[model samples]
Target chain A: MKIAIIQFGGSNCDMDVLHIFKDILNVNAELVWYKNKDLSGYDGVVLPGGFSYGDYLRSGAIASRTPIMDSVKKIANEGKPVLGICNGFQILTEASLLDGALMTNSYPKFICDWTYLKVENNNTIFTSRFNEGEVIKIPVAHKEGNYYNTPERLNELNNNHQVAFRYVNQKGHLTNESNPNGSVENIAGITNSKGNVLGLMPHPERAAESILGSKDGLKLFLSMVDYFSNE
Target chain B: MEYYAEVTVQLKDGMLDPEGSTIKRALEHLGYSPKDVKSAKKFIITIESESIDKAKDTVDEMCRRLIANPVIHDYSIIMREA
Candidate 1:
């Protein structure tokens, strides 16, 4: 399946995503520059991490206005799987493709570490590889990964099962300290109402190999592969 | 006529502002009893317009379209002749 990795100016994780998908997963993935608006050939799309538009005004705020995002939105609307990681998550929210904004971390520092994620909903295309409530380790690197949404909206998201992942301890218990960012409800990852567009603060591509300290992330990518092959 | 539009964007009330809170804490540490600190962004844009009323409408539109995120931010626009 052909996958397009949208690359905006200052998007550093574009290469890493391409390498993981092309070299590791053997998926036909190409990096599409921000100005190239056409995205018809790609079956799936990924907006990986990095300080897009130099994180000016806000993380992903300026990048979201780039030309290529219009095509990305169209693909997402067509029910194609669109995954946004780190700054990519910020861009998705900024573009209104996803709900809520990622704010500065509560501690007010950039955090870079491995954290445990609990699979809150395994029924979606993005999390179907893992069982519900399963714990997986992934790396998170961002200054503004804290997710914020109105309390009413958070409840709505929960009722719809749009919340796909939540922060948890190694033992799989959700606690205040387990949350690296002060995101309400410890949200680590979430999906669109249609269950196609997925956004998360962690770098799943960085965790695709066991040599990188965790292989848990590969399952999610493999799940994407499974999702397209079945379609 | 040249009109200057100044836009101030702030987080919606009741939303948490970590950066603002951090600043509040720092002030408290320095013996200031500031109960809260809310941060906002200001953008000034100069444009040609036929009238002040027309400029006001245009700047308001700009706020909705680009200067503010309606979901999390509330923005106000002020227009003045330049």
Candidate 2:
């Protein structure tokens, strides 16, 4: 399946994700510039991480308003898979494609470290390869990754099984120490109610190779491929 | 009419302001007792419209659409003749 990895200005991780998709996953993936608004040809889209627009105004504010997001949204609404990572997740929230917002971390420091993610739901196309409650290693690097939403809305997300992943400890337990960012409910990722769109703060692309410390991230991309193949 | 609209965007009440809290702690270390702290952003925008009411509407829409994220922020706009 052909995947469009949309690249915005200042997006540094575009190449890395492109390499993973092409070299590791053996998939046909291309780096599509943000100005290229046509995504109809691609089977899936990925918004890679970086300081788009130099993170002016907010982490993903300026980039979310760009013309390319319209095409991204159009494809997402068509039930095509869309994966947003790190700053990409911020853009999805800013674009209102996903629920909640990624706010400044509670420590208010630029955090770069590895984190354990407990797969809260595995029913989606993005997580079908994983088992519910399975824990995986991923890396996160950002200053604004604290996910926030109103209490009622959070409950709605939980009830709807939209929370796809959450921060956890080695023993698969949720704790304050495990929560690198003070996200409400220690959330690290979430999916849209339809389960076609997934957004997360961690850099799964960085962890896709064993040499990079973990190959746990490969399953996420593989899951998408499996979905497309099944269709 | 040319109008200047000053928009203030702040996190909604009960939302934690980590930067503000860190600053508050620093102030305490300096022997100053502070109840709490909050951080906000201010944007001064100039808009040309037919009337003051229209200018207010434009500024308000800007805040709603761009300047503020309704999920966690509240914004206020003050319009005056430019």
Candidate 3:
């Protein structure tokens, strides 16, 4: 399947995402500049991580208003799969593609390290490869990764099974210590109401290759491939 | 005539307050009572308009579209004729 990795100004992980799609998954992928409006040819879109707009006026605040985001919204509305990683997740929140806002970490520090993520809902196209409650290791790096949603909205997300991942301890138990940013309910990733769009504060592209220390993140990409291939 | 509009945006209750908590800690260290203190942001805009209604409309639009994220932040706009 052809995947489009969106490249916005200051997007640092676009190349890494592209390489994972091309070199690892052997899928047809291309980098789509943020100014491009046409996304008709691509089956899926990936918003990779980085300090978009240098994180000047809040993380992802300025990048969310880029011209290409209109097309991104259109594609997402069409039920095509879309994944936002790290700063891309922040942009998705800023763009209202997903619910809730990512705020400063409760600890007030930028955290960067491999974090254990529990797969909360594996039925979605993004996490179908993993079983529910299974823990996966991925790297998270962000200062504003704490997810904040109203109690009513959080309840709705829980009822709809929209929560995708939760930080977990090494023993596979969910704990506060596992939460890198003190996100609500230890949430690390979530999906839109339609379940077609997902946003996670982890750097899956950074761990797609075993040579990079681990290949656990490859399953996420492979799961997306399986999703489109089955359609 | 010149009019001033005050817009205050605050996070909804029950939402985590990392920034506010940080300030509270700093204030506590300074030997001040910072308990139950919540932080908010405000924007004061001065505009030249013919009528108060026109100024209110303009500032309301700004608050709705730019100053606040309706999903998380609630804002109040107050106008004062200058």
**Best-performing candidate as measured by lDDT:** 2
- State the weakest 10-residue window (summed lDDT) of model 3 chain A: A56-65
Among these predictions, the greatest DockQ belongs to 2
Candidate 3 residue runs with Cα over 4 Å from true position:
B1-6, B42-50, B78-82
Q: Estimate each model's TM-score.
A: 0.96, 0.98, 0.91
DockQ of all candidates, in order? 0.68, 0.89, 0.53
Whichever of 1 and 3 has more TM-score, that candidate is 1
Task: Tell me the whole-model lDDT of each prediction, alpha carbons only.
Answer: 0.91, 0.93, 0.89
Question: By TM-score, highest first, what's the ranking?
Answer: 2, 1, 3
Quality of candidate 1's docking, in CAPRI categories?
medium
Candidate 2 per-residue C-alpha lDDT over A1-231 given as tens digits, one digit per residue, 9 for 90 to 100? 899999999898899989988998789999999988888889999999999999888889999999999999999999999999999999999999999999999988999999999999999999999998999999999999999998899999999999999999988999999999999999999999999999999998999988999999988988998998899
Query: Per-residue lDDT for A72 in model 2?
Result: 92
Per-chain TM-score, chain A, candidate 2: 0.99
Docking class of 3: medium
User: Can you write out model 2's per-residue Cα lDDT over B1-82, one digit (the tens) per residue?
Assistant: 7999999999999898988899899999999999988889999999999999999998898888888999999999888999
Worst 10 residues of 3 chain B by lDDT: B63-72
Write the number of the candidate with greater DockQ, choosing between 1 and 2: 2
Q: What's the C-alpha lDDT at position B38 in model 3?
A: 71
